[model samples]
Target: MKLKSGCFLQHLHLLLKYTACMSVRNAAALMEHFQLLDVHRKNYLNDLQFYCFLCYVTDLNKDKIMLLFDLLDRNVRGRICFNEFYTVVYTLLSHENDLEKQFIPRHAGRAFQLLDVDRDNMIDFNEFEAKRFLFNIQKEVKKIFKDIGISGDEQLNYREFKIFAVFCIDKQQKEEGDHE
Candidate 1:
């Protein structure tokens, strides 16, 4: 579970390229769409296929897609695993959803760049606490943050956010009931 400094920094560098997102449900829909592509028989999103996928999933311009290709295409092998694809899509979708909800949607991405003060791509309790006042649904966002933190260390990593999003459906349903 521990990452070497070099690897950690490498990921940190890639994170700086982020700035937008969609919704978890849309992310799932994207996953399903990818699965049905019948392309990338090897289950890898390569340079050529990656472009096609991006075009299919979003209206992001070529330059931006190239930027994302650099970040999401880990290993520089000109390809991305499902996990990587999901990460990129989820990150974008999360941001998109937040925008729709008017929550951290303006700063770009699901979590917002402002939260990662240290620019390490992860949000610790301190960062979350510092920006707590920025969110409309403070309690809900905080609870989601806690639920997304799987390390038990109060740090919400990119991967954990994916898990958190998967369960947010229930949270939405609950919120609807409360509102009613």
Candidate 2:
């Protein structure tokens, strides 16, 4: 549940995008929905309410929803505030959307931009290894470099990085499918 700096920024970017797309009326409606879900009038949702809300909004099963709820409930207080609810829901929605698009080149470009901290237009092993968690890649960095760096220059330009990103996402999705 602990996100690295780059992953945190990505989630923040997603939340900002979600907020940008939300109309005032839609925001109000969401607030009202949150209020309704706060049956105890505590201005927060317990596990049951969160589970129901996730079930209504997403296709995830009971167990997964509960697990998501647990993750979102950062304080272990058995409740999640409206901000936590909003952030986590939008982040989940954004991730699902990204998956649907199969993480295209544009997405890879943005990811590369984030990882290339020096604006060098290339990613060295350190940069790639630092941000590897964002792509859910647990493989050894050197092995991945050998596999995807077709140019064998020991650095990844956008094209090579795109291939690496796609490879990681494909592997992550396959692993998720296996769990399912």
Candidate 3:
């Protein structure tokens, strides 16, 4: 879907790491986790395996998984390919910003409020995804979270989020542009 250009490999690596942590699974285990053996597939997960994988993720429920599955099945196909799975995982889990959804309003205050969905005065991943329109790029959501939090806080207050909006993402884009 034309997400950030250089993010595919990095996000794929990170997603692999996350999967390993879920249950000590390696490449072969990953295939088995998605039940590749059952379906005689190389990298795709079938409908049942999709449900299992969703249950494997942290803090996820059936309803949310269904919603995500429906969205990722862009062509209404019954199965989710590995690439599609990666994109969905990246979207749901990664915290980096790739600028795929260009046009974050320059208004940092409103942006902060929108991202702070729980109204807990801080921004966490869940809240970030709620207003995901803010950074609809590749799987850089985690990186964005880290870059914005100067003090390395697990969550960010409005001030930190502002710094992220004002400087971090712009700098990131500029740096990416330079590399290209």
Best by TM-score: 2
Pull out the clashing pairs in model 3: 94-142, 95-140, 95-141, 95-142, 96-140, 96-141, 96-142, 97-140
lDDT per residue as tens, model 3, 1-180: 223444322333233332322223333444444454246555566667777655655345667566556555655677677656644444433333343223233334545654565568898766665445434433456777776676677688887876655454566667779999
Q: Count backbone clashes in candidate 3.
A: 8
Assess each prediction's global lDDT (C-alpha) against the native: 0.53, 0.62, 0.53
Those runs of model 1 whose alpha carbons end farther than 4 Å from true positions after fitting are 1-30, 99-180
User: How many angstroms is residue 114 displaced in model 2 relative to the true structure, after the best TM-score fit?
Assistant: 19
Off by over 4 Å in 3: 1-43, 96-180
Q: Of the candidates shown, which would achieve the greatest lDDT relative to the real structure?
A: 2
Backbone clash count, each prediction separately: 6, 0, 8
User: Between the candidate structures 1 and 2, which one is better when assessed by lDDT?
Assistant: 2
Q: Which of the two, 2 or 3, has more TM-score?
A: 2
TM-score of each: 0.40, 0.46, 0.37
lDDT of 3 at 35: 57
For candidate 2, lDDT tens digit of each residue in 1-180? 222333322333232432333445545666787898898999999998887766655556776566556555645799988877765544444464454124334356556665676678888888777555344466645777777877777788889988877676677667778999
